[model samples]
Target: MVKYVEGSFNEDYIQTLGVNFMDKKVQIKSTNITFLIWDLGGEKEFINMLPLVSNDAVAILFMFDLTRKSTLNSIKDWYRQVRGFNKSAIPFLVGTKYDEFVELDFQDQEEITQQALRFGKAMKLPVIFCSTSHSINVQKIFKVILAKAFGVKLVLDEIVNVGEPILVYK
Candidate 1:
């Protein structure tokens, strides 16, 4: 998961087998605010540690596989657990594996997208469809987190003029 956020695409990685959690201190490029990111595995054994890790979270991101409906259904349970720990934490619903999802039929794609939208609406959280393999919306997700955490307006410079130098002020 950290590799995904950091823009490393390795599809051959194996799934996590146990209740493992890792933390990394990352600096948001847009805001320059250092954030401690706790990547928790979604295993039953990790349920007990939710409160301990999420107590100081500014934002919580619940990601599910777009090609799997069951993963989407599990978001409710995850959201509930996170909210129990920190009601004030901003929540984000992320649909991953978008590269695979696009290969599905139009009807299937629309159905999954609609379902995800409904869940996001019901949870009152923003939804993002991303493909780490294709580097889609990966950075945007963190930018949204930074904006929400610090109440800052984010204007992403998607394209810069050749001669114009970009500057980031502290």
Candidate 2:
């Protein structure tokens, strides 16, 4: 996945090039298209550290565990807050775990999925289900984001196709 600094420039910011500088403070590049990814720490204590989101943010990928109904419940409020901060109707929604769904309690899974679908309609965002551990549709997530970012369509040719052009750095 891509990584970038969350806040404004500081003394810690460094300049470098290519894969050799993977650990640089800020790294920017393009495979098929340029990605200005911002990595925000998922810590409750860092609530005050809201990074400045650009007007051109084509998508907002909100991820959560499908087994956790509590987290899914909070998505609506989070969507509300994000909408308040960003008036743009960017494509944004929850991404649930794919493989873990079968292992989770049936009630929790159903409840979260139902809530997600409801909020998705209310917020007009597309909910993308994924599993990073099994590599299940993880790349598709980026493809959706990039397609939305560029305003295009992603076509699938076969049952397990990575679309027409698979541009993966790793």
How well does each candidate superpose onto the true structure, as a TM-score?
A: 0.80, 0.65
Backbone clashes, candidate 2: 0
Please provide, for model 1 over 1-170, each residue's C-alpha lDDT reduced to its tens digit, 9 standing for 90 to 100.
55544547667866655434554456555434555667666666878778866898888888788889889888899898888889998888888877888788778777777777778778888777877787777777777777777777877643212111111111
Compute the lDDT for candidate 1: 0.71
Per the 3 Å backbone cut-off, how many clashing residue pairs does candidate 1 have? 0
How badly does each model clash, as a count of residue pairs? Answer: 0, 0
Worst 10 residues of 1 by lDDT: 161-170
How does model 2 fare in lDDT? 0.50
What TM-score number comes out for model 2?
0.65
List lDDT for all candidates, in order: 0.71, 0.50
Query: Clash pairs of candidate 1?
Result: none
lDDT by residue (1-170, candidate 2, tens digit) is 32221223233533222211112132113434555554443334433433344234556665566667676666665566556656674655545455777576667556656666666677676666665555665656666666665666666332211111111111
Best by lDDT: 1
